[model samples]
Structures are given as C-alpha cells and as structure tokens.
Target: MIIANISIPLLGMVDTAVMGHLDSAQYLGAVAVGSIIFSFLFWGFGFLRMATTGLVAQAFGRNDTTLSHTILLQSLVLAIIIASAILILKQPLSQLAFLLIDSSEIVSQQARIYFDIRIWSTPAILINYVFLGWLIGKQASKAALVLVLVVTISNMIMDLVFVNVFGMTIDGVALASLIAEYLGLITGLYLLKRHGVTIKLFKRLSSKQVSLFNWHWLQLHANIFIRTLCLMFSFAFFTTQGAKQGDIILAANAVLLNFITLMAFVLDGFANATEVLSGKAVGAKNRSQLKQSLLLTGLWSFVVASLFSLSYLFFGQQLISLMTSITDVQTTANNYLPWLMLMPVVAVWTYLFDGLFIGTTRSIEMRNTMLLSTLCCFLPAWYFLQPLGNHGLWLALLLFLAARGVSQCFYLPRILRMY
Candidate 1:
C-alpha cells in the first residue's frame, strides 16, 4: 500500500526533476503550475476514490459481493459524468485557473500548452482513480502496487524520450502523463478481470436499492467533494502565492512541495491501510478493532514520518540539487528546507485522522473540520503574514494541516461513542 501510494507523488517528482534541469527556471515553474491545476481539478474528484474505498471496504468486509460490485459501478458512473463535464468546461476552467494563478508570461504560456494537451486524459485519469480505490478496498495491495508501478515507470521513460530525445520540455512531461493515464486505465481494467471481479452497470437494482444508494452515496460524496475542494484550494492558493514571489521562489517552492508530497504519500500507505482495516471493522461492527486499527496505523505512520523528517533535514539540499541544476533555485529551495523538515511530523496527524474518518465514512465531520482548517486557519494566517513572504506561506500551510487534525480530534470523542 505504501509503495503504491508513494508512486503517486514520485510521478510528479519525476516530472519536476526532468523539467528542473532545463536551461530556465520557467520550465520547472510551468510544470509546477500545470501540475497543481490538475491536482486541483483531479483531486477535487478524489471523492470518487475515497467514497468508493469506504463503501467497498465495508461491503467486502461483510462479504457482500453484490454491494461491492454496485459501489464500483456507481463510482465509475459518477467519474464518467464528472470527466465529461470537465471536458465540456475545459475552456472556461483553463481561463479561470490561469486567472487565479500568478505566473510569468513564458511560464503561463508553457503551462497552458501542457494543460491543453493533458486535458484529453480526463476520463482515463478518473477511471484509474476508481480502479485504484476498488483494488485497495478489496485488499489487493499487490495488484494496486503493480498498477502504480507500471504507470509511473512508464511515465518516467516516456518523459525521458520526449524531453531529451524530442526536446518537448513541459509539453513532453504532460504528454507522458496523458499517455500513461490511458495505459493505466487499460492495466487497471485488466487487473479487475484477472481478479475475477465483474461489474455489471445496468443490472436490475430494486427501486428502493437505487434510491438508498443514490441518497446516501450522493450525500457522502457531496460532503467529500466540498472537503476535497477546500483542501485543494488551500494548496492552490499556496502555489499562486508562491508564484507571486518570482520564478525562482516559485520553482523552489514547487520542488519543496514535492518533498511535502513525498512525505504525505509515504505516510499515506499506512494511513490507507487504516482505511481498509477500519472500514472492515465498521462493517463488522467491531468497535475494538476500529480503535485498535487507528492506534496501530497512527503509531506506524509517525514512525515513518520520523524517518522522513530526518531524511528531509539531512539530505534536503542534495535532493533539491538533484531536482534542479539552477544554482539560484537550489539555494532558494535550501533556504526554506527547514519547513520541509517539519512538514512530516507536523502534517502526519491530519493525514492519519483523514484515513480514520474516511474509513468510517464520516464525511460530514471530515468536511467541517477541513473547512475550518482551510477557511478559518490557513487563509487568514497567510493574509496577515503575507509581508513575511514564503515563510508566511509555509507557516499557514503547516497551521492549516495542524488545525485539520486538532479540529477533527474534538469529533473523535463523539465518534467513538457511536461505536
């Protein structure tokens, strides 16, 4: 699970590393801008994955194959609709996205090229999300790991060929990602068949079943959609503000953000394990197991977080240099390296808590806490501390993360009572 989750960010890191060594910082910044736009766009639909995981894990736990199959179909249906809407609105979405972002003209132009090219992969990307969530929920970690590994490695190879051999630069990375998504979708679909789980989308569900599924599923996912939107917005805001500081700072922050992503996805392995175990416990109505799962996963996540913190503190500069050859960008990234060092330990709790809440399908609480953390905690801090420059941005993000966990803590007492 950890291996699979880590690959998600590593894909972006590869993209960054490829562009980072380019002649100009603008290429890296362009990739950074383009990546975050997709992050905001795609991660907003992460409810497709999270909601599917929660629902399917519970069904799998209860040994209810029908429900499990139905959940996948429902999620994919939602994914297709959302993907089509994104395609339809691609023009205005791009305009509004670039409008909110602050970027140099060259960077903005390059980012648009990347966006225009990659937008075509929308449906494939969303389908991959649903497939990954299904595999994780079914506890098919090995298969999930294989899926991610194939796509990421494929992406890296394509990136090299396109960037180095063909001189495509930013567009090369975007094209690599576009091609990889379709490949991943094909691989994922094959994996589903190999696992011998068949999905029949239009099977005759009772009227009551359809109503219940629609009502509860939509409610759960709507909350998650809003939660994901706010979460992505905070990061997007961070990127936009970083861009305002100039291309070097933007590029440096972009590199540093990858480090944060590294820590998040690494810890998320155990965090996701919690989802499977805890969701199963919820299905079985085993309170003790749920509590135990949370404790074990939380403890293990922190252990990994400790290792990551040390890694960042000790080798951050070397890692920064590996990402970009630009001396100014490397030095700028190093200046803020300490923040990355603190990110793992500081951010671990929110991530751990997220897994717990998500597993038990507490979407409303998840939404509320995230809303408070972002709107109440992060944005205001950034506004007041803007004069301090990037430090303010980093601090606001840290506080935002911390606030998410702390706010969620208050709800835990009530949640535990439910069990």
Candidate 2:
C-alpha cells in the first residue's frame, strides 16, 4: 500500500516539475489552480471510495461474500450516476470554480484549458476510485498496487511525451491525466474479473438489491461527502490565498504543496492499512485486534512522518530547486521550507484518525470534527494572521490539522466502547 500510495504523488510531482521548468510561472500556477478545482469537484465525491472501503471491509470481516459483491456493484452504480451529473454540469461548474479562485488573467486562461480537457475524465476517474476502494477493502494489496502503477506510469510517460516530444503545455498535462484515468479504469475492471467479480455477479443482484438509495447508505455517504468537502475546501482556500499574493507566490506555493502531498500519500499508506484492519476488527467485534492495529499503524505513521521532517530540514532547498529553475520561485519556496518541514509531524495525526474513522464507518464524527477544525480553527487563524503573509497561511493550516486530530481524540473512547 505504501508503494502504491507513493506513486500517486509522483505523478503530481512530475506535473509540477514539467510546468515549473517553463519560462513563465503562470504555467505552474495554472496546473496548481486547475488541480485544486478537480480536487474540489472529484474529491467532493470521495465518499464513494471511503464508504465503499468501510462497508466492504466490514463485509469481508464477517466472511460475507454476497454482501461484499453487493457493495461493490452499488458503489459502481453510484460512481456512474455522479459522474454523469458532473459531465452534464461541467460548464457551470467550470465557471463557478474560476469565479471563486482569484488567479491572474494569464493563469486563469491556461487553467481553463487544463480544466476543459480534464473534465471529460470524470467517469473514468470516479470508477477508478470505486475499483481502488473495493480492492483495498478485500485486502488485495498487490492488485491495488498494480492498478495504481498502471495509471501513474502511463500518466508520467504521456506527460513527458506530450510536453517534451510534442511541445504541448498545460493541455498536455490535462490530456495525460485523462488518458491515464481511463487506462486505470480498464485495468481495474480486469483485476476485478480475475478476482471473480464479473458481469455475472451484477446479474445475480436483484433490482431491489441494486437500488442503494436507502437512508442508511445515503446518510453514510452524505457525512463523508461533507467531510471530504471541508478537506478540499481547506486546500483550495490555501491555493486561492496564495494566488492573491501574485504569480511567484502562487507557483512557489504550488511547489511546496507537492511536499505536503508527498508526505500525506506516504503517511496515508499506514492509514489505508489501518482502515482495512480496523474495519475488519469492528466487523468481527474484536476489541483487541482493533487496538493492536491502531497502535502499530500509529507508531509507524509517526516514525515515517519524523523521517519526512528530517529530510526536509536538510534537503528542502535542493528539492525546491529541482522542482523549478526560476530564481524568484525557488527563493520564495525556500523561504517557506520550514513550514513544509513542520507539516508532516503535525498532519500525521489527522491522517491516522481519518483512517480509523473511515474504517469504522463513523462518518458523522468525521464530518463534525472537520467542520470544527476548518470553521473554528483554520478560518479564524487565517483571519487574524493576515499580517504575517504566507507564513501565517501555513500556520493556520497546521492549526487546522492539529485541531482535527485533537478534536477527534474525544471520539476515540466512544468508538472503543462500542466495540
């Protein structure tokens, strides 16, 4: 899972590196803004992945193959429905996203180009999410790893070919992603068939079973959707604020955000493990297994996070330079390296707790805690620290992460007691 998760960020780094080397910072800024818009749009429906993993993991724990298959089918149906709606509303959605982001005229124009091409990948990306969640829930890590590798490797290759060989720009990056997502979806379907999850399984599901719009499922997805929205909003807000500072700051911030994302995907490997193990424990009603899984994953998460901080402390500037050649952007990113160094350790807890909550299917707590962190902690800190510039924004983000972990601590006992 760790190997698989790390590949996810490598694609983003490649995109940033490709754009960052360009003569204009607007190119990098465009990718950053465009990526965030998709993050808001697609990740808002992240509940499809989280809910599928939690529910399917529980079914696996109970040794209920029928229920597991049902969950997978339902999730796929939901993904297609949501993706269709997104495609239908793409124009209005694009306009609304650009309206909310205060980027420069040049950056906005390029970002729209990126958005226009990438928006068409909605169905492929959403279905890929369901495939990933289902594979992870079944504890099929090797298959899941293969699916991710296919997407990342193909995307990276296409990114280089389109950008370097064909001399494309942000549009190249967007096209690469669109192609790779469909490739991933195709790979996922093949893997599912190999695991005996076939079209025949869908035929076995009755019309009543196929309909998953009940209160229980809807409530679960709703809470997770809210939680995901809050998470994406925080990142989007960070990008928007940086854009307001000018193109240099926007590009530099984009470079630094790759560090945060790299750290997150690395740590989230442990979180993913925690989700499967903890969800299984809950399904089996095994308190000791749950506690043991949490203890081990949490310990490893902190250790890995510390390694990230140390690496950043020593090699941060070199990383900034490698991502971009622009002197102004490199210097600006270097100035903010300390904040990147601090992020891993501070944010690790949030990832850990999120995994635990998702594994146990505790979406309401996830939603409430994120709301408190974003609304009460992040926004207020940013509002008061406007005088401190970008440093203040980073600080506010750290506070938000800290608030999520701390607030979630209060809910841990209840989870344990329930089991």
Candidate 3:
C-alpha cells in the first residue's frame, strides 16, 4: 500500500519537476496557484472519501452489505452534482482564485489555462475518491493499490509524452491529469464490479435508509467539509503569502510544498491501515481492539515519519535540485528545506488522528479541533510573525500542524471514553 501510495506524491513531484525546469519561474507558480485552488475546491469535499471509508468500513464490519452500497451510491451522486456545479461556476471560481493568489500577470494567465483544462476532471476525481475509499473500507487494499498504481504510472508516462515530447508545458500537465483521472475512474468502476459492488445507480430507497442518509449523512459530512476547508486554507494561505514575496520565492515554496505533500501521502498508508482496523473495531463495538489499533498504528506512523525526516534532513538539497535546474530557485528552496525535513515529524500526528477520527465517524471533533487550531493558533502566529517573511510562513504552518495535534490531545480522553 505504501509503495502504491508513493505514486500520489510522485505524480505531483513530476509535475513540479516539469514546470520547475521551464524557462520562466511562472510555469511552476502557475501550476502551484492552480493546484492550490483545486486543493481548496476538491479537498473541501474530501468527505466523499473519508466519510465513505468510515461508513462503509462500519457496514462491512457489521456484515451490512446493502448499507455500504447505499453509502457509495449517495456519495457518488453528491460528487457528480458538486462537480457539475464547479463546471458551471468555473468563471467565478477562477476569478476568485486569482483574486486570492495575486500572482504575476503571466503566471495568472498560465494558471487560468491549467485551471480551465483541469477543472473538468472533478467528476472522475471525486468518483475515484469514493471507489478508493470503498475498496480500503472493505480491506481490499491490493485492489486500491492497483488503482493507485494505474493512476501514478499512467500520469507519469502521459506527463512525459505530453509535456516533454509534445512541448505542452503546463497545459500538457493539465491534460495528462485529465486523461489519467478518467482512466483511473474506469479502472475503479471495473474493480468495484469485480468486488461484487452492483453497478446500479438507481437503487430503490427505503424510508429508514432515506432517513439515515438524509439527516445523519448530511450531519456527518458537513462537519468533515468544514474541517477539510480549515486544513486546506492553511496551505492555501502559505502559497498566497509566497506569491506575494516574488516569483522565485513562489516557485521555490511551490517546489518545497511538494516535498511536504509527498511525505504526507507516503505516511498516509499507515493512516489508511488505522482507518481499516479502527473502523472495523468501531463497527464490531470492540473497544479493546480500537484502543490497540490506535496505539500500534500511532507507533508505526511516528517511526515512519521520523525516517522520512531523516532522509529529508540529509538529502533535501539534492532532491530540490532534481526538481528545478534554475539556480535561483534551487538556492531559495534550500533556504526553506529544513521546514520540509521537520514536516513529517510534526505533521504525522494530524494524519494519524485524522484517520482515527474519520474511522470512528468523529467528524464533529475533527471539525472543532481544526477550527481551534487554524483560527486560534495558526492565524495568530502567522499574523505576528509576518515580518519574518517566508521564515514566518513555514513557522506558521509548523504551528498549524502542531496545534492540530496538540488540540486533539485534549479531546483524546473524551474520544476514548465515548468509545
């Protein structure tokens, strides 16, 4: 699972590498701004996956197969509706995104190009998120792994063909992503069927099922929606601040941010394991197993995060150079390299608790914890530390991650007590 999950970041890293080597720093900044906008757009609805994982894993544990499918069907329908709305609101979305980012005119235009081409991938992307979560919820990780491999490998090859061979630059990258998502979605649907998930979208709904999905479902997912927004905003703010600094810093911070994301996804494999084990425990009402899974996975996640930090602390410059050939960008990225090295250590806590909370369907706690962290800790720290420039940005992010972990500590006893 970890090997396959590596591809998630590898794809983004490759995108950064491609744009970083371009003649203008604007290419990297454009992709950065464009990606941050989508992160806000797509990740805000990330409840589709997280909520599905919790609900489906619980259903599977209880041997309620029909309920799992109900969750899947409703989530997919919601995903399509959201994606369609995004398509209709693309103009206003782009306008608001550029307004927040305030990039160079050239970078803004290029970002628009990437955004215009890539926005259409939302339906496929969201559907695939549901499929991946469902597979993981059922402990069909090998299948989920296969789907990720398909996405990662296909995206890399396409990126090479479209960008390097065809000279499409940023557009090529966007097009590659568009095609890759559809391919992954097809593969996911096939896998879902093979796993005995009926392909019928129009299932007859029972009143009880409708009631379960209506109020309970909306409540569970709405909290996750707010939590995800807070998390996305921290990084979005980082990129916006970086853009304000200048193109080199923006490009440099963009490249470094990939390192942070790469580590997050890599360690997320352990979190995925936590989701499966913990959700199953919750469903079976096995408190001992839930407690045990949390302890064991927390240890594993921490060890793995430390190993990642060690590697980054030592080889960050070399890795940064691999992404961009521009000497100025390279130099500026190295200045911020220490933060990436420390990121895995500080950020792993958030990832672990996130999986635990999601598995237990504790979305309200997740929302409240992040709300407190983002508004109380992150914003205040960043506001006071703004004079420190990019240093301040990295520090603020570190605090955001740390604050998320720390605030959750106060809630851990209550969480465990309830279970």
The lDDT for every candidate, in the order shown, is 0.90, 0.94, 0.89
Span of 10 residues, lowest total lDDT, candidate 2: 205-214
Residue 383, model 3: Cα distance from true site in angstroms: 0.8
| Candidate that beats the other on lDDT, 1 or 2, i.e. the better one | 2
Clashes of 3: 0
Best by lDDT: 2
Model 3 Cα shift for residue 322 (angstroms): 0.6
lDDT of 3 by residue, 1-419 (tens): 67777889899999999888889898999989989999998888889888999989889889988788788888888888888999899899889989988788999999999999999999999998889888889889899998988988898899899988988988999999999999999999899989877645334554345533588889999999999999999889989999999999999999998988888897788788888888999889998989999999999999999998999988999999999999999999999888888899999998899889989999889999999999999999999999999999999999999999998877888878777
**Stretches of candidate 3 above 4 Å error?**
200-212
What's the TM-score of every candidate structure? 0.97, 0.99, 0.97
TM-score of candidate 1 versus the correct structure, residues matched by position: 0.97
Cα lDDT of model 2 by residue, 1-419, tens digit: 99999999999999999999989999999999999999998989988888999988899999999888888888888999999999999999999999999999999999999999999999999999999999999999999999999999999999999999999999999999999999999999999999999887788786445665678888999999999999999999999999999999999999999989999999989989999999999999999999999999999999999999999999999999999999999999999999999899999998998899999999999999999999999999999999999999999998999999899999999998888
In model 3, which residue pairs have backbone atoms overlapping below 3 Å? none
Clashes of each: 0, 0, 0
The lDDT ranking, best first, is 2, 1, 3
